[model samples]
Target: MRSRNSRLGTAAALAGLIAGTAMAGCSTTGMDASDTITIALAANPTGAFDPYRNREFGISEVAPFTHDSLLYKTPEGEFVSRLAATWKADNTSATFTLTPGITCADGSALTAKDVAAAINFASDAANASWAYGYYTPTAPLTAVGDDASRTVRVTVAQPYGYLLDTVGLLPILCAAGVKDPDSLANRSNGTGPYVVSAVSTGETIELKRRDDYAWGPDGTTVADAPATVVFRQIADETTAANLLLSGDVNIANVSGPNSDRVRAAGLDSADAYTAAAWLNFNQREGRATSDRRVREALVHALDFKEVIAVSTNTHGVAAEGLLVTEPAVCPTNAVAGVLPGQDLERAAKLLDEAGWVLGSDGKRVKDGVPLTLGLRYWTDRSELERPTAELLAARWKAIGVGIEPIGENVGGLVKTLYQTGNFDVYLLGWDLRLGSQFIPYLSGPLPPRGQNFMALDNPEYVKLSAEANATTPPQGCDLWGKAERAVVNDFDLVPISNRVTSLFYRGVTGQLTPVEPTSLRATQ
Candidate 1:
């Protein structure tokens, strides 16, 4: 592993930062910052705008602007009504009161039946939703049109107490868009405040504000916004930050040393929490990390506090569980001290106990095989991911373990890490922009078929999760809390950083959360 070189761009960013700061104070601008909110994205969407098929992180960030959901949640996981003006549900079913007279981008009026069809589409077993397990209907979900009642009724074939939690985040689609999702690669038809005008792969997506749109969450409307919103894929974090500073772009999501440098340049910012970075151990046979003890030992080997400080620029804390930071459905401290502290001696002892003895090179070996872990991480993901991998390698090395760090682009991660099962341990982090309680990890599809990279098969977790899904409110959330604790406490996955970082932008009015996909932030 290469030595920790901070942010890879911050040191060189001094000049760019200075120039950016100086430029920010000037009014020599050409673009109408008031008429357009240009966002500098780290990467382009993988392709298309199909809610069922688009699992790319970049796309998730953009979907909300082009679609509406039955409900909404703040980044903190606080639930609120959305398309469904009033929703009431039981363990097995839900009924939604449709907002009167809302229209789709197609100029078609929305109905309760439309919302129900969306829920069914998203929950299909063949769907590619990242949270497929959470949204997958245990039984067929059906929608009944009841215009006289001014409501749409959806019945979950089986028990589903927390169905709305996952259902609420789904972007409701028109019948045509749902039938031919590929058509949305460059177009859209939804109830959102904007319609995707054009999609330039690897470059930009242009959106024009919907003058007819008036139904926002909680009966709100977009009173202040640019007539057009432009999303630019800059790829480089420093470049994005510099662009934002130079008024070339109004908003950008940047983190680590880059985030520090940009904010130091005096830009307005919004801090929002994202899911924690984590380590997923491949438990398939012949992989060294299959042993649970080894996983726990590795967790104990690193001083996460030190790693996080360098990685997040003090924007994060050591994570306790999957629900890292939250206005979450279930908030608890299951992670506090549940993990073994950074104790090399303890790690060494655990390795010794596990039959991995230190050899002449001071690296642990079992039988004739050395304990070398293959670590794969996303390339150019953030300023933190690469350095974090290096620091992690160093920490494990200090405890007589060997790790080979490999860099893969975001697109390559799913193929290499999950499909090919190419690595023993891989770096993964979920952006819980929409809270689904992470039920997929316990009972979702395994690699090649889905994103369950860990392949964790815990029956207790499944039972608890099932029970939780069939219950309501705090009861369901409370059960999920137990399941999360069970998996995490067993050291199935290692936590890295749980952070709330500020998105530095200009002329944006409403607050936004990195985790809530449907939370649209408009201009002031």
Candidate 2:
């Protein structure tokens, strides 16, 4: 193992790659000198523009362009105001005052009604927004207008001090655009600087700037935005890179390792270690994984370095704790990372301790049954799951643990097996954008609560997770440290590594900072 001080050095050295082949066959004619900024989405939103009910896709990128969220995150990951200028909270209630003169693309003024409608939509049972999980505010939204004033007021049903930050990214919707209150999905009524021009399934989506728009915490003016932005859904990574390198598109969101190829091809790239690649354990299943000792053994059996090598470049930050990075909470005594390599001796010890012994086929037999598990990967076969799962299975097999590679219809079977806790083991990922609830992946699925599909129930971890979520920013650093330590000590779950979001840009487009995509300043 490399010394702790050399972790980053090792990561950088491991990022080298041989010459790559470009795959995107886009037209190079108009794209070479075009003013339009085209972005290639790695994966399109699952369906529609709703964030609540859908578990994956749609909200993050689309919302930012078509709707002005309450709070926005700069590419650097800092939060800034969008619709609500400033907010305050007391012991029992939190309130947000709207910024004046903000208008929808249709020229309708943004008001308290828009804010209320948006939140109500998410909080409503019918909407089923996955974004709702991050919102801690349970208060029924009460919209009020000061009789003698044009400013509006928003109060929670209960005291939720962190409501503003929790609902920070909720997009305010124009009431006029919402024709029915009962419908869970709708699109294009947002008060952002841009308006949706068209959305085509499995192809491309487009947005047009609102010439009269003027509002962003930074006082950004969209009066001069490009006529339109076309987001093409290009699933192939090599193809996307080829387009950027060949000057067929203005930007492409490629992987970290490929960033080198883009530059080698005479283009530029920008990247941020945004999220991490992780394996989620379906706890509902009762098998070798049902035991903590077995889980720890499996974690120790797989070499994370190899996983990172095959997965992507950047060695993606190796995460020992749940909250992939800082500002995301961790326990006070959290270890920097979990076990990194296969310790056959340790794996055997853990297996022996759990009363499992090797059988004739070289697989462990516990209670008259071979410790074999059925593992499933997404059939879309896109993500790094295929190789990661194969590597994991191979390591476990060497340690007398049998892992059965199950090929099934992608989404449905995987979800069914996990939710019902019927499979021996399953692999998946949980997005960490909901920073504070780092432990919910484990806690939410515990029995009775029923969300803890993993069925991992520990009083201490639950307490630590709750404390972390309830913590305020002033105590953020300290609280996170405490939470991280607790999670690492339990060894209840294994965290792989953090992921970086890569944006590929072709030739020059003015003097925009690579860190900032598309626009120069909020005002630009």
TM-scores, all models, native as reference: 0.85, 0.78
lDDT of 1 by residue, 380-469 (tens): 456566877888898888888888999776567657755687888777655431124466654567755655667777677777867776
The residue pairs in collision within model 1 are 76-327, 433-515, 433-516
Clashes of each: 3, 34
> CA lDDT of each candidate?
0.65, 0.53
Cα-lDDT of candidate 1? 0.65
